[model samples]
Target chain A: MSDLKIIKLVKNFVGMDRPAVNNVNLKINSGELVAFLGPSGCGKTTILKMITGLFAPDNGDIVLDNKSLLPIPTEKRGVVMVFQNYLLFPYMNVNENVGFALKMKGIDKNVIEKKVREMLDLVKLPDIGFRRPKQLSGGQQQRVALARALIASPRLLLLDEPLSNLDAHLRDEMRDLIVTIQKELNVTTIFVTHDQEEAVLLADKIALIFDGELQNYTSPKNYYEQPKNIKAAKFFGGVNFIKSKKINNEFISDIGKINYVGENINDLNDEINITVRPENIKLSKTNDFDHNSFKGNIKSIIFSGTHTRYKIIINNLELECSLQSLGIKNINQGDEIFVHLPKDKIWGMND
Target chain B: MGGERLKIILSLTPPLLIIITLFFGGIFYGFLQSLGYQPAIGKYDINFSAYYNVMFSERYSKLFWTGLGLNLWVSFASTFLAAVFALFGALAIRKTFFAKTVCNFIYSLNLPMPHLVVAVGMIFVFSQSGLLARFASQLGLINSPGDFPVLVRDKYGFGIILAYIWKEAAFFFIILMSVLQSLGENFEELAQSLGANRWQRFRYVILPLVMPNLFSASIIVFAFSFGAYEVPALLGVIYPQMLPVMAFEFFLNPDLNARSEGMALSIIIALIVMILVVFYFWLTQAKIRKD
Candidate 1:
């Protein structure tokens, strides 16, 4: 296990005024798998490369286990990265590829062979010691790359979109394998990806970066439920942003006024923006006439696999709603409906 | 279907007939002449006398043996040296854009320059009274041009080997650059992440991936250097001449019997090149199997 601290990291490329990685700071705890989640070109992969010493940071230090890694070369930094393409050396067979690092360190032949076999078994590929990389399938090659990376016992393991090249089914399997192996070894790992779902599924903590800046660093649930800004919120999924006014003690929107349920609502500007996730807006066939309930017509119904999404129109305002299709009757478009915006799930933010 | 098949066959017949008639016909006629069956001289009887005279005759044996040895040395040395220089040159300039342009221009500048021109350039640059010798004398490294070391037209064929390397290294550089560009930096980056340093990445990963291409390129350089006539003709000494130069000299003789001997020497050179090519393929295939 290793703790990593990235302090004020900056990297400026030529012919660009804006730095690729701007003054980014992160503290990764020991034995934690943190996912740097964002859209593409959000400086997530740049940060990973800087930590691995592939790209030099213009101004900052990466301290691993309280020692600065700037002075160490890439090979001596003990940071291993599994690239997006799973760059297994095409010329080497499975066992030789896995044993390459130990051989580089001048380990004994018998011991390296034993360790290679052990790593292969750990990756659940015990029978492919003699096969070339081309002979293996995508998932199998991924395992070989992972096995090769892990055999070195690196201080920090970095995976850069490790499953982006695999098919959907193989991506799931590779994700589970990586999570299990990370847990079993208790190795501190950083996974850089643009897929928010993958981050939410596998990361202990997700650091959301946007436009070369760190937006939020917290648990996956908090990243999804309590995004700090509108950009971070939209990255998780779709959200209905409402322009509201803080009148008296209530927040007034086109949908209606609701009691403020947030800690920073009082200190915020009179005009604010609030968001409610689509799934949180519940729908029913009959009106309960509650304060948060409003009569609306189902303008459209999109039948997805496991759930149905409805676009509801109430008082000339459109709102998105999602509900599970398992126990509900078939809700048709243009049907009269009632939407309940739960007071707890309606989140407010300052303009 | 029969008409379509006939059309395809007709489309291919011109090139195939040209190859079979012109190329193979010339090779067969040359082989027959080398075997001492020359219809031009009305010597229809086939004999091993020309090959024996070229290999072990009193008047020509010394030149023949030394020419064979020098041909092997010059071809092997130049090919190996050119490949090494080109590989290092390509690896060094592949990263930086400005360096790539400048280094690429300097290395590939010779690619279009003819080998005859480069051999002449070698004389102008490396001869005792050449530009380098004059510059060295002015710098006080030598007292005069006559004090400069012999390089061009030397007995050991160093000047010929140098000329070949100068011309062929560009060819090698072009081949290696394309290969290295296609390969990209991912493998080296991954190797570095796996705790292999710069030299290790090159030795274990880069060298193996590019070896087959480099080997094939070297074969072309070696074969061309062995069978070519102009460079050695311009830069080599009369004694201990290269095989092609010696064979051309035999052809220049007035005796018709000597032309058969020249054909035998040319055939021997071709056989050597073919054997080396087959051996190279076998070796590379064995390396692939081992991997």
Candidate 2:
């Protein structure tokens, strides 16, 4: 197991006005699985490549196990990257591909064969040694890539959107496989992904980045619930922002009025932004006069099988709400309903 | 559906008919003459006399056998050298944009040049009294032009091999560059991440991916060099000439009967090239089946 630290990393591509990656710093604990999460062109994969030594950083240092990795070549650094496409060597069969690193190290032929078999079995592919990569399904090829990366026992394993190419069903299976194998081996791992759910599901911590800068690095739960700013909040899922003014320690917005739930609000800011997740807002057919409750007409109803989403307008303020589909009656457009925005679930940001 | 099928066949028939009329037609005429059935000389009776004379008759056997050896030597050597050089050249220049452009332009500069012009170019540069010899004497590296080594028309056919390498290396370079461009650097990056060094990645990843194209390109170079006439004719030594040059000499003979021997030598060269091409095809197919 090894810990990795990135210090003020930056990369400026030629002919580009801005750096692809700019002044980012992160520290991952030993045996910790971290996910660099962001949207496309956010430099998440660029950070992974820099860590794996595929690309050089223009500034800053990457230290693995308290030693600087900038001076080491990729092969000697014991860092392996499983690409998004699972770029398996098409010329070699499964056994050869997995055993390639061992062969390069001049391991004994019998030892390589035995180790390769063990790796294949670990990836749940016991009898696929003779098959070429093209002959395998997408999931099988992903497993082969994982087996090959793990067989070398790399100090740090980097995965660049390894499941984005997989279909929905296979994505879950591969995700479980990767998480299980990563925990079983206890190797330090970092995976880059544009998917929020995958990052939340697989990573011990999620590091959110945007526009080549680190936004927040924290536990997945905290990172989702307590984002640093409006952009980070919107990236995780749907968020409803209530423009409110603080009056006599009570917040008043277009929806309704609610007393402050948290500690001392003795500051001088009159206007502020209060963010609540769509799922946090409860919807009901009848109003019980609850805290922060308002009556609204459904502007639109989106039926997404698992959950039903409603765009509701209350006093000219549009608020999105999602409710579980279980045992729910038919809800249509333009129906009057009450939206309860829990005070405890709402977060206030002053800028 | 019938009309579509007829239209496809009609579109294909003109080229197919021309191929049959020109290519196979010429081969058939050559074979007829090789079998000693030359109606031009009014020798109607067909026999293997010309082949026998070319292969074993006391008078011409030595020249025919020596020419065959020289043909094989120049073709195989030049093909191997040119392919190795081109592979390295393409690999070296593929990374950077400026280097790729400049190197590619220089590498392919000789591609459109005629084979005969290249052969004469080799003569101007490599002959003892040529440019290099004069430059060497003027630089005081040698006493006179006579002190320069004989590279053109030498006994070892060095000059002919050099000319073929200069011309054919460009063909191999173009094929290899296209292959390398399509392959990209993803596999190499993956291999490096898997703990493979530069040489290891090349051997295990890049070489195997490029081998099929390389082999196919080599077959073309080998076949062309083996049967090509002008280069060897201009640069070959007198004692052991290349087969095409020897056959051309046989055709230049005053006797009408000499045409059959020339046709027989030409047929022999064609048969050798056909056998090589078939062998390469079989080898590549077998590899595919194994995979």
Best by lDDT: 2
Docking class for candidate 2: medium
True contacts kept of each: 0.77, 0.85
Query: Candidate 1 on B116-214: residue-level lDDT in tens?
Result: 999999999999989999999999999999899999999988999899888998899989999999999989988898899888988999999899899
Candidate 2: true interface contacts recovered? 0.85
Question: Tens digits of per-residue lDDT for model 1 on A1-351?
Answer: 499999999988887768888888889999999999988988999998888888999999999999999989899999999998888888788999999999889899999999999999989999999999988999999999999999999989999998888999999998999999999999999999999999989899999998888888999887556667788888888567777898887788887776667666667788888778998888888876465787889999888989888999988888888889889776789899888877778777773
Off by over 4 Å in 1: A263-269, A285-291, A329-332, B1-14, B285-291
Over the true interface, candidate 1 deviates by an RMSD, in Å, of: 1.3
Which residue pairs collide in model 1, if any? none
Q: Number of clashes in model 2?
A: 0
Per-residue lDDT of model 2, residues A81-173, tens digit only:
999999888888999999988998999999999999999999999999999888999999999999999999989999999899999999999
* C-alpha lDDT of residue A230 in model 1: 82
